[model samples]
Target: MATFQRHRAFPWLLLLPQLAIVAIFFFWPAFQALRRSFYVQDAFGLGERFVGLSNYVAVLTSALWQQALVNTLLFSASVALGAMSIALLLATLADRVLRGAKGYRTLLIWPYAVAPAAAGVLWLFLFDPSLGIISRALGSLGIHWNQRLNGGQAMLLVIIASVWQQMSYNFIFFLAGLQSIPASLLESAAIDGAGPWRRFWTITFPLLSPTTFFLLVMNTIYAFFETFGTIDTTTGGGPNNATTTLVYKIYQDGIVGLDLGGSSAQSVILMVLVGLLTLIQFRYVERRVQYY
Candidate 1:
């Protein structure tokens, strides 16, 4: 009994520092934001009056808010899908085919080591309409691609930029998951005359379900929140608010507009949406994750 208690207490003690940091930095700020959302900012932004749920109603009723919400959801879903798919394909190819696989893996993950803002800047240069390298290449083919003039192109650029940055993370996770699967199982499948695709779908994919589920949750949150840098650098939510996602809108309200109350309300909504998504994924897909 003493040993079990000591073991558990030791782990808790080790976690105390991190837990304290989270409480102070994360939970406290979130609670403050929630409290602030019920208030209104004064003319000079010095005072706040308790407006109850009016701010929430205002945000919900606003058409611009609605568009931001939809754009956020679409961006999150598309980027997560694109990142996961491309990473899975790359990891599979590296695991199966490529010579000097470790070298290739190192090279592949190198882009992720670059700072997010730097990566965004690099991609912006490549996609720049006037004097970009890729722009020149497309011009040779008489294909004009201008993200600034087109909303769809702007969204695509954002998605591609996000996917490019995140694929490394997904690739590492998936490669680890693939490598963890026992060779005996794959050998048995091969003996049963299963093709590579069939073996992967029937045997490997099921084993990888847990990793996939984890990545889906993490990547969704990341796509929604952490891609703000990329969006800020690449699009500035431009072309008539076409690329303005919820996080960017929050930034515009809180930081740029100095409307802390409205921004807090937006934050509350974002937190609720993310919480619901996480819950749904764990509740529904968790049972489907089979382990060897």
Candidate 2:
């Protein structure tokens, strides 16, 4: 709300574009969804009638919603942990590389720039049961790699694709965090008979805590919201809805099933859950993060 003393409207003018964008794209839709969550309409869309908390009650009590919730938790956690771990390992190796480092870094970061849907398609091609290269290779090894028929295989395939899509983003942050670390502390540790593992555990890891904490939050959000496109393209939440996440469920209800009220209620629940999660992380998780 602060403004210039001489021209009070200048700061407001400067913020107008961003404010307008947020209102149009985020706030307005959210308000509409909130208003709609409490109402129900006939199949033909003749009229909508407010039904108290019927939609919310139905959604919460539904067995499908429960399953989606479980799947979402598993998928989000797997993607966040898997992506961050793989990215950290790659960043560590790249940091130690003395030759062709730029090329290595560029190749590693290329996946981050790939569109989520495109990345999903790439993996889908690689994991297709009959025609996929990797799938055929697995079949040759006596492993039936049919994601289309196997629920576990479908979930695993989605997790791998999601992790690969997110790894580059984590790599960039982790690499920056690694490079920001002062070399002196590491050298002193080495001089005192500390090995790479000990130095990482005691010195490097602590310094990277802030970056790790940040990536944890960002990755959680990404896994929750941004993976929708990837899931849609790859599995379409298929194989008996095994890979169907909460967000995907929302889409299934709203767009596919045409259950506007239920979908809106689910959306509100999702929004609250994500907001609560972020608040919890900042309130509690950040306590362990070392900024200095």
Candidate 3:
């Protein structure tokens, strides 16, 4: 009995390191953020005071925060949809290619290795109004291109940069999902006189639902948090705070503005928002996500 119990506990023992890492890194910082949310810290970190819900109320009531929230939602939705749609299309095409498929897949996946900041900088150079090739081309066409000053243009640039950076990651997943669908099933559907579009809608698309749902959740989170580097490098949350997202606002307030309590409160709120969003996806969206 003792030996059997020891063996039963062996797996948990092996997992202990990972469990400790999670607790120390993820849970500990989260706890600190929660604790700090209720306390106002002096700018120099020399003093602090318990302010309770005032920080939360201030963040929630602030007009700037409200704008940031809206921007975050719009940015997240656009990036998720744009990246996933393009990725799915590319993956489908790649899967159908009999020749150079490996090379094509490698090219599609290479962009994922580029750092987010690097991706942002690359796009920025391409869109630089004065000297960029694309910008110069647009200039000749009489459509002035200056993202630095135009709020809409800045937002659009950031969205494009984000989508470009994320598309590769989504492509890999979509390609794998596409490849996983049994060829025999598609062959059978084709033999039944189903056209390419009909076959895709009736078979491929439905079968990819699980992967699509998963990517939706991940891409949403990526847009909310991971795009910080891209926005920082490209727009810096930009002209008149047009592209200021919730994550960017948190960094600007907490790290740059030195409003520790308010930022912590914002962080806590963001955590709750992400948690709720994920829960909603899993609870409702999962029903439609067909798993093979």
Candidate 4:
């Protein structure tokens, strides 16, 4: 009995380091943010006073906060849908090619390896109004392109940059999902008079539901937090706050505006939003995920 108990506890012993890291790095900071959300503090941290829920109230009532919420939703939805759709298409095409499949996959996955900030800067250079190659090309076509001054254009540029950075990740997962699908099932569907499109709809798509659902959750979270670098480098949430997301707003409030209490409250709210969204996805969306 002692030996058996020792073996069981050994696994947990192995997990201790990881658990300690999480507690120290993630839980500790989250706890600090939560505590700070309830207190007002000076910019220099020379003084602090408990203010209860006032910070939350201020954040909820602010028009800028509401605008950031709307912008975040739009950005998240656009990035998730655009990235997943393009990745799926590319994965599907890549899977069909019999020659140079590894080479094609290598090229497809290279974008995901690029740092998000670097990717954003690259796109910004291509779209910069003053000297961008694309901007000049657009001028030649009589379409004025200035993302800095145009709210819609700024939003579009950030979304495109975010999507481009994330596409390769989705592609790798989708390609793996596609390859995992049994060939016999598709062969049987084709034998039963289903056309290529029909077989894909009936067999391929249904089998891929699991991958799609997983990517949906992951992409939503990525858009919420990981796209901060992209937005910062591309637009800085500028041009009348057209592309200001909640995370960016938190940075602006805490670092730039020096409103620590309000920023903490916003961070807490964002944490709650992420939790709720994740719960809703797992509760409703997971039911249809069709895991094999």
* TM-score per candidate, chains pooled: 0.94, 0.96, 0.96, 0.97
TM-score of 1: 0.94
Q: Which is better, 3 or 4, measured by lDDT? A: 4
State residue 142's C-alpha deviation in candidate 3, in Å. Answer: 2.2
Q: After superposition, how far is residue 3 of candidate 1 from its true place, in Å?
A: 5.7
Q: Per-residue lDDT of 12-47 in model 2, one digit per residue for the tens?
A: 999999999999999999999998999997657899
**Candidate 1 C-alpha lDDT tens digits along 1-292:** 8777769778888999999999999999999999999999853767779999999999999898999988888999999999999999998888885678889899889878877788888889998999789877987899787889888888988999899999999999999999999999999999999999999999989999989999999899889899999999999998888899999999999998988889999999999988998999999988898865
**Model 3 misplaced regions, further than 4 Å:** 1-4, 7-9
Error of 2 at 270 (Å): 0.2
TM-score of 4: 0.97
- The lDDT of model 2 is 0.94
**What lDDT is reached at residue 290 by model 1?**
85
Cα RMSD of predicted structure 1: 2.1
Worst 10 residues of 4 by lDDT: 1-10
Sequence-dependent TM-score of model 2: 0.96
lDDT of 4 by residue, 221-276 (tens): 99999998899999999989999999999999999999889999999999999999
Better of 1 and 3 by TM-score: 3
